[model samples]
Target chain A: MSAITLFGILDVLGTFVFGLSGAMVAIRRQLDIFGILVLAAATGVAGGIVRDLLLGDTPPAVFSTLRPLSAVCAAAVCAFFFGALIDRLKRPVMLFDAIGLGVFAVAGCEKALAHGLAAPGAILLGVITAIGGGMLRDMMATEVPRVLREEVYALAALAGAAIYVIALRLGLTETIAASAGVLLAVALRIASVRFGWQLPRAPGS
Target chain B: MSAITLFGILDVLGTFVFGLSGAMVAIRRQLDIFGILVLAAATGVAGGIVRDLLLGDTPPAVFSTLRPLSAVCAAAVCAFFFGALIDRLKRPVMLFDAIGLGVFAVAGCEKALAHGLAAPGAILLGVITAIGGGMLRDMMATEVPRVLREEVYALAALAGAAIYVIALRLGLTETIAASAGVLLAVALRIASVRFGWQLPRAPGS
Candidate 1:
């Protein structure tokens, strides 16, 4: 597949999983249907929209195309109908989330580089794209973002972004570099969750 | 003054007050110097950046020019040094915030219309620009956004935007319309705060 096609697939997959996660959160918060759908769309497209905006891409893909909207709608509808079942399958949902995070990080990094951003900007945008959606969801739900308070979620994204940039610098093919970044991010995130790894807190209570 | 110069003054003033508000919040949360500065900049420029992005204006003003950054820095430094005094001057800070809200709402609406957005889109963007920064700040502080939960804050912005749009449609001069919008919003917000006006809560506790 062309690099564009590969990234497109990753983008849709990430949007779907992130939308599902957002819908689940809305359900838990007892929001009405409209709120659920809004949250789902917001969480699914916010990162990509922000990234596109930073790159000066007008009428972001989410606005110019139908696929992302359809993906978000599908996820929201699925979660609305099967929230209980998904709640019982917490491990599966978390695994999907990890995968989504990794894909988004790689796709975002690639896009930033394609837009001629320097390494630092590219890497930062990559991490932001990975974590931005979930951060928005948590913020709307009035909670501290999980990435800021616990786990190594953002660290995992950072590692993936850094790896992608370095691999590209070392002349790796796009596909191979992307795969390496995604795999490492997913593995690191899952490992952190499973092993209860967390960054240190402030010096005192 | 030209409309552009008028809006520029409002934008800078709004950025400064919003940055001050954000810095004060960071101080209250006991964040260190870097954290305070980050919050100040984020709160100051986030709304404008989002507005510019949606309008397809890349390398947002905050990035392309030094005025907004300087305003944010000034506010942050001021708050860092005088947080205690500012804390005691809560009423004055709130007054400044109301002014910021009014100016941002009008400026955002004007920009949206200038970009050829329909009435609904323009009004929505106006409200978003007015409340977006504060919502971000509240979210960063791990609290429900004040606009979502209490007071007549967002309503005031909405009213201002509506007035601006209507006046424009009525062929009012740009200055008159803008002045009317800003004055109404500021008056409404200040009145609401002084009189403890609040939107009704959900049916039950």
Candidate 2:
């Protein structure tokens, strides 16, 4: 498959899992149907929108394209209906989230690079792309952002994106570089969770 | 003064007040100094950034310049130090916030229209510019967005933006159009607060 097609697939998958995560949060918060849908859409696309905005890509891909929106809707519906089932399968849910995070982190880096952003900008955008949606979701739920908490999540995405930036800078092919980045993110995230590795917190934060 | 200069001044002042609002929220939430600074910056600029991005303005004015950042810093410091004094000047604080809302709402509308957006998009963006920062601050504090609440806040800004859009469509000069929009927003907002006017909520929302 072409790189474009692969990225498209990755975007849809990421949106689906992210949407599921958002819907789960809304469900836990006891929000109404509209609230659940809002959270799902925000969680699925907010990061990309933020990355695009920062990079000056107008109208955003999520606005021009339909796949991300459809994926979000599908995820929200499935999540709402199978809330209990999903809750009982925490491991599967977490695995999906990690997959989404890894893919999005790489994609974000690539998109910023395509927009001619410098490495630092690209890396930061990549991390934002992975965590922005979830951060917004947490904010809406009146909870502390998981990113700002003790989780190693944002740093993992940052490392993954930085790898992609370096790989590309070193003349690696697009697909190979992206794959390397995504793999690092997924492995790091899953390992962190499994090993209970936590980022240090500020005193009394 | 030229319109450009006026707008520059307005943007700085708006950011300053918005930052103060954010710092206050963070302080009340018992966040540390870093959190206070983060919230202040986010609240001061997020709205304007959102407006610029949606309107296809890249790097956002805030990112390209130092004034907005400096204003946020100053406001955070003032809010942190003179917290009680600011609290005592409730009426003045409210008025400054109203001014910020009015100027930002009109600025948002004008920017979108300059970018070839239609009246509807311009109007919506205008309102977004007025309230985006506060909504973000609320989210960071883990509260529902004030815009989505039952308050008449966003509607007041909407009405102001819509007026600006209509006035410009009818061949009004930019100065007159903007002034009219600002006045309407400020008046409506203050009146709404004074009269306790609220947008009706859905059943059990």
Candidate 3:
């Protein structure tokens, strides 16, 4: 597949899953329709936008183009109607989000690399892009960002991106490197949840 | 004075005030050194970065240049050391923040217009840029944004931007237009604070 095709698929899937996550938060907060849509869109594209900005890509594709924007809107609508059912299957929903997170992490890394960013900057951008949407969603909803609070959220993304960067340097093909990144991120996230892994909080209460 | 000169000065001054505000919030939350620095930098530059991205300006000046970054760092350091004294002088600080808000609002609008954005797009970007830093700061600190609360905060910025756009369209000098925008925003903010002005929150809320 062409690079655009590969990244596009991952981007859409990530946007949809993130949109669902954001919509779920809005539902829990009893927000109005406008708030729900805003949160959903914010979660879907804010990360990519930030990454694009950092990489000096002007007019982020997510904002100027229509495909990703449409995907986010569609996801928001789906979540709005089926939130109750989705909420009931929390475990499966989380698994989907984990996969989506990995997809986003790898995609962000690859995009940064393609844009000529150095390894370290690309790795940092990958993690930032993976977490930016959810952070924006929580902020808009007046809550703490889940990534900063607990668990190995950003760390998992970071590891995945780092794996991708190393794989690239080691002569792996684009598809293989991307796949490895995705798999690693997803596995780490699932394991963290299953094993109750968490980073220690501040020293005292 | 020239438009660029006026905006450059106001931007630097606004960055300082916002850095102070972000640092104050960080101190109140009792975050670590890293968190304080991040919050300060985010508040100082996040707004302009968002605006530049939306306008398709690559490599935002705040990140590419040293002056603004230095200003943010200085603000963070000052707030870290004298937070108690600054906290005690709440009234004066409030007045300073209000003026900073006006300065940022006008600068954002003018910058957007200078970049060839049409009136509507310019207005929206202006509002986003005016509020972007504060929203990011609050999100980083895990709190609801002050602009979304019970006050005439964002409205003041919006009104100011709108005034600037209108004044420019009416054949006014850039200096005069910018000045008018600043005056209106400051007056509205101060009046809102002094006279208990507030936007109606939801119909029954």
Candidate 4:
């Protein structure tokens, strides 16, 4: 498959996983069916929408194409029907979330670079695209975003995007760069969770 | 002044007031200077940015123009320096918030209409623009958005935007439609607060 085709496939996969995560959150919060769908869609597509908006990419892909939207809806419906089963698979969900983060980070960085954003801009947008959805989801749930308080979540995304940009700058192949970025992000995320690593907090409460 | 010019002026004023509200919230949360400024800017321009993005307006006005950015900065700086004084004037702050809501709602609706959005789309965008910033602010502060739980806040914005669209459809002049919308929104918001009016909540907490 072409690079663009691969990216598109992974993006849909990421959307499905993120949508599942959102659906679980809504179920945990006792939200109604409509609320589950809303959260699912928001967590699945919000980040990409923001990234596209920043790049002046009109009518963001999610709005223009059905694949991503379909993925989200399918995931939400699956979770709704299998809430108890999914609830018991917390570790698997986290694994999927980590993979989604990595995929999104690499995808976001590549798109930014394709749009001629400078290195710093590309990296920032990549991180934003990777983390924005979860942030929005947490906000909607009235919680401080996990990116702000969790185990190196945003930092892993930043590292992933930065590595991808650096590898490209150093004349690496696009495939190599993308793979390196995604692998690093997923590994770091999983390691952080396993080891309970955390960024330091400010002094006092 | 032309309708466009008037809308521009009110938009900046709305940005300033919303920025002040954000700054005050940051101060109340004991955030540092950088945090206050970040919240201020987010509260000031996020709504407009979202509206512009959804309408496919590239390089959102806040990024392309200095007026809105400068207004947010000025509000943040003022709030940082005069926090004690501003804190004592909660009623005034709320009044300004209500005015900002009306102005933003009208501006968003006009922009959406200019971009060829239909009535429902325009009204939805308008309400989103009016409530978006504060919703973001509360989210960043880890609070349930006041619009979701407060006294008829989003309803007022919805009513305002709907009125604007209806008036325009009825062949009212732009100025008349905008004025009616703003007046009704501000009046409704203030009255809601004054009378402790609230939308009914879901049962059993």
Best by DockQ: 2
Question: What is each predicted model's overall lDDT from 0 to 1?
Answer: 0.84, 0.83, 0.80, 0.85
Q: Give the Å error, residue B77, model 1.
A: 15
Docking class of 4: incorrect
Q: How many pairs collide in each candidate, listed in order? A: 0, 1, 0, 0
Off by over 4 Å in 3: A1-3, A139-144, A195-205, B1-49, B53-127, B133-142, B146-205
Candidate 1 TM-score on chain B: 0.96
> For residues A107-203, could you state the per-residue lDDT of candidate 3 as single tens digits?
8898898898899999999999999999888778777789888588899999999999999999998888988998899899999999999777779
Docking class of 3: incorrect
For model 2, the TM-score of its B chain against the native B chain is 0.94
Task: Kindly state the fnat score of candidate 3.
Answer: 0.26
Tens digits of per-residue lDDT for model 2, A148-197: 55346876797889888889889999988988898898888889889998
- Give per-model TM-scores: 0.61, 0.62, 0.61, 0.61
DockQ scores of all models, one per candidate: 0.16, 0.18, 0.17, 0.15
lDDT of each residue in A39-97, candidate 1, tens digit only: 99988888888778787876677898999899989998998999999999999888888
Per-residue C-alpha lDDT of model 2 across residues B144-191, encoded as one tens digit per residue: 877787457888789889988888889998888888888899899898
Q: Can you give the lDDT of residue B168 in candidate 3?
A: 87
- Give the Cα error of residue A117 in candidate 3, in Å: 3.3
Tell how far residue A96 is off in model 1, in angstroms: 1.3
Interface RMSD of 1: 5.2
* Candidate 2 backbone collisions, by pair: A142-B142
Between candidates 2 and 4, name the one with more favorable lDDT: 4
